[model samples]
Target: MSPDLRVIVYPPDAQGGRRVRVDGEILGRALGPNDLFEFLRQAAQDADDVCLDDGLLIEWRGGGPALGSPDAA
Candidate 1:
């Protein structure tokens, strides 16, 4: 993982949306949960793990998206 690259997602707002932060910078309004993956992909980010607001962990391995770590419960 690149030290300059980190994703931070804030808890849901009144409309059940989240604000995504890439390296401590925000784009505009909050984004839907489904858009997270698309954002990362468009940004060319190849992450081993994606940490959500509720602590749900999504991982990318071998260029595919998975819900969680393969070694965890």
Candidate 2:
């Protein structure tokens, strides 16, 4: 099986903590405890690429879809 690219956040001094959101939403926190494999599997199915706050990027296979023409900023 191929390797999955993703990051899992472990709580500090706590169990069943929040999971960080992959999208570009700062000050946002994930709700509920989740399994790493399951979360990445689902995210990979939807979005082709995922970015983290710490300058870490996890891209899916096939490089995902290409962006459209450069329209606006």
- Which candidate wins on lDDT? 1
What would the per-residue lDDT of candidate 1 be over residues 20-64, giving only the tens digit for each residue? 566656643334434675566555665344443323332222222
Alpha-carbon lDDT of model 1:
0.46
Each candidate's lDDT (Cα)?
Answer: 0.46, 0.32
Candidate 2 lDDT by residue in tens digits, 1-73: 1234344343322332343433432222233322323465455533234332223443322221111112211
lDDT for 55 (candidate 2): 30
Against the true structure, candidate 2 reaches a TM-score of: 0.28
lDDT of 1 at 34: 47
